[model samples]
Target chain A: MAEIQLKDLAHSYAADPEHTTDYAIHQMNHVWEQGGAYALLGPSGCGKSTLLNIISGLVKPSHGSVLFDGVVMNDISPQDRNIAQVFQFPVIYDSMTVYDNLAFPLRNMKVIESEVDEKVRAVADILELNSILQQKANNLSADQKQKISMGRGLVRDDVSAILFDEPLTVIDPNLKWKLRRKLKQIHERYNLTMVYVTHDQLEASTFADKIALMYEGKIVQFGTPRELFENPNHTFVGYFIGSPGMNLLEIEVTAEGAKMGEITVCLNDQQRRLLKSAGNASLKLGIRPEFVQLSSQSNDESMPCTLVHTEDLGTYKIVTVMLGEHSIKVRLDEEQQVPEQNAYLNFPSQWLKFYADDYLIVTDETGDKS
Target chain B: MNKIQNNRAWFLVLPVFILVAFSAIIPLMTVVNYSVQDIFDQNNAYFVGVEWYRDVLQDPRLQDSLLRQFMYSGSVLAIEIPLGIAVALMMPTRGAMASLSLILLAIPLLIPWNVVGTIWQIFARADIGLLGYAINGMGIEYNYATNATDAWLTVVLMDVWHWTSLIALLCYSGLRAIPDAYYQAAKIDRASDWAIFKYIQLPKLKGVLIIGVLLRFMDSFMIYTEPFVLTGGGPGNSTTFLSQTLTKMAIGQFDIGPAAAFSMIYFLIVLLVSWLFFTTISQLDKNKT
Candidate 1:
């Protein structure tokens, strides 16, 4: 396995592109370590799959270079790249047996018969496909067929990396978890450089060592799952990486503090200086619903708000609050009795995130201990 | 779920069944009747039982035509299947260029069968046609009208040109139906071009290729228009296929009894082959299920 490095990479489907906006993927540079498991996570229409394709040599980026072991692979064909890919749906030869499907690559490269058999059997064993080795590949169930597809990629040990493009999309939900676990186990055992791309936040977070959060053809943040959850660098990342997503309330910043409609909240000296020089005095405060504390008594550091509605979500109660015409969501404990009337709510100062001009302004990182 | 279930929908199919009964079934029944009798003329006929069937089955011409038909169809399929797939492999997979290429490939398929024959006939003439003129100009003797090898080559080439597109189109559709994920898997596997084709493309194409094979086989077996238009059974009987020979006995000879028996045998052979094809395909599908 080799470390994959993407340098100044930008791809544009447009001809004679004039600006960065014309590109499908904006310029970015990052390195995925050798034998590392990484995930490219984004919503549909984002450039996550495009980035995967570029690395695989299926798509040649309009700008920048992709390096495997520091060697530029801009013009290399996919076959020569020595990367194995598993698609969303299974791609197996129906005419060939499962053994043959897995052995085909080896056979094509003119590997010796005895070795090919050994390799095929080993891959089949890993994929739990030994019993179905002699059966035609098309005769397998959807999930089994997908496993055969994975085995076909895994059989060849010489590949630089194995790329999975939403490989579990067609698998049953229960089966998906098992396969993901199996994939993680395989990666750990083999130490293969595996890159998985998915739009599902849970899949991305749970499967990869590092997750690259993407939005609108750009990689907003690439970090560990915990890092993404705790300190999202961009507002988009904050919104994307969470369940109900982070709630951002627009406010006016001043010397004393910020004003959210009629309420004026006090800020510390450092927070005030940061907001003053933050270019636009207009700022937004972001806090995840999980971080928002609901209290019965009013506190000095808390923003007073009224409860609007509560949705019981089995484990917790998702309480909606109206703060000066703006709506915010807060999650409360399921066992706790929800405030029935015009009860006051509070936003903890430690959990507050400042945003300016739609970008997450990170002037203050002193409060975060996690 | 509470929508009306109307029986009036059967009216849409009534006209088709009537047309088919008159145009297909009645003529088939008439042919069946003639196969079991001896007819001297339009009016003078007698019941001769299976005597004619036995006599026609023993004819050497019948054996030759059947052999020729098999060779012809087999050769056509052997050449067309791979050639079509190869052409499809070279085609662009996306954008306006791919669309344009598909439209261009579709042109040959849309051309009338008799017209295709006429085009090949003139195109292979030694004195005038481009192919014949060019080959002769290159100091090689190539006359499709007068030579058996030349006639066979011309017919095979003509059939390939006429039908390879159909196979290619079917293969293209199959190839196009494959999601990008499959290619991704192949890429990461470091699968060679041949591996991708064998393990991915060929298996994916099994359904359509079966259709392609069946259609091409049936068409090639019953092919009377092109070869008849091009060579008229040739200088000898070198190119006289089963369908042509059957037509000759039924129309040229006008010996109703033997012709009827020949036709029945021809129909049976086609029916048997089609049944074999269907069963084989169904078996493959069943194994998959």
Candidate 2:
């Protein structure tokens, strides 16, 4: 495995290069280190899959260069790239036995019969496909077929990397965990540079060592899952990565502090300076639902909100509230006593993120808002 | 959910079965009647029992025609199926080109069977036809009309031209139905082009190829119109396949008893062969179990 570098890589479906901004990827410059398990996570049509395909050599970028260990691979075919891919659905040969399906790539490379058998058996063992090795691949269930598809990719040890494009979409929810666990085990054992594309945050976070969160046609943020959750550079990432997502309430900033309607919340000196330097008139406050505390009685600094309803989701309750016209959600503790009609909303002492024009403005801990 | 009474569903299928029976059963019964009774004319007839069947079973002409039919179907299938797959593999997956290729392929299938024969007959003539003229111009003695080997070549070539496209189209449809993920999986496996075809494309194409084989087999084995129009079973009966032989006994000589026996033998051979093909393929599909 060698480091794959994307140098100002951008792509457009159009014939001519419009601009860097006009491209789907928009000048992405990053290195996926050798043996790293990375994920391109985003919603539909966000250019995450495009980036994955480019790395796999299935697609060529409109601008910049893709370098594999410092050698240009911009025009290299997928076969020449030494990469394997598992698709959204099963791609196993229906007529061939599971064993043959697994052995195919090895045979193509002109490996001896005994070696092919050994390798096929090894992959089949990893995939828990040993029981059905003699069976035809088409007769298998969707999950089994997908396993064969995965096995076909995994069987070849010579591949530089393996790519997955929503490989679990066709799999049953109950079986997904098992398959994912199996995949993780195989990745750990093989240490192939793996790039996965998925819209599911949980899948991305669980599978990838580092996640590249894409928005529109650009990578909004690339970081570890913990870093993404704790510190989002863009408001979109903050909103996208969390369940009950991050609440972004528009606020007005003045010389005194940040104001929402008649309420004015004071900011510390550094935060005030940061807001002043931001230059954008529009301000927004974002925080995870887990951080917001709800109570019956208001504190002097607490924001007032009307209790709408609460949804019991086993371990936690998602309490909905109407703050002016906007609905804010708070994840209330399962064991905590329910708050009354009028709930006072207290933003967590830490984890307050301030944004200006969709870009992060200030992320301060310790309630000081610096 | 409302419970559905499925008895009404059978009513929908009634018309189709009735139509098939009318087209199939009446002709079959008439053939049976002819196979048993010797009819000197429309008015004069006598019960021949199994005599006609025995005679037909013993005929060398019947044996030759049956053998030729199998050979023709076998050769055509062997050539067409793989060639079709190769052509399909080379075709574009999407866009105007795919649709254009489909329309172009469907043109030969749309032409009347008799017209295909006529077209080939004219197209392979030495004096006027381009193919014949070109071949002769190449300093090769080529006359499909007079030579047995040339006649066989012309017939086989015509068949390939007429039917290979059909198999290709079927294979193309199957290939199109394959999700892009499979290709990706193959790529990830580091599978070579031939490996992809053998393991991925070929397996995916089995259903279509089965249909192609069955359709081509039935058509080739019962081939009559084209050869009938082109050679008229000439060049010393070298191109007289089963259907043409049956036609001669049934229509030209009007020997109803023997003709009926001959046709039943022809029909049984087709039925038995087709059943064998179907069962064998289906069993192979099941063996993957």
Error of 2 at A40 (Å): 2.1
The all-Cα superposition gives candidate 1 an RMSD in Å to the true structure of: 4.0
The residue-by-residue lDDT of candidate 1 on A55-137, one tens digit each, is: 98889999999999999999998888878878777887677788888887787678999999999998888888888888877
The CAPRI quality class of candidate 2 comes to medium
lDDT of 1 at A216: 84
Candidates' chain A TM-scores: 0.95, 0.94
Q: What is the C-alpha lDDT profile of model 2 across B1-289, one tens digit per residue? A: 9988889899999999999889999889898998999887889999989999999999999889888888888888888888888888888878999889888888888888789899999999988999998999999988988999999889888888888899989999999888886787677566777777877788778888888899999989888898889888878989999989988887888777898988888889889989999999888766657
What lDDT is reached at residue B236 by model 1? Answer: 93
- What is candidate 2's lDDT per residue for A330-349, written digit by digit as tens? 88789975687667888764
- Report the CA-based lDDT of candidate 2 relative to the real structure: 0.84
User: TM-score of model 1 relative to the true fold?
Assistant: 0.88
The two-chain DockQ for each candidate, comma-separated, is: 0.48, 0.59
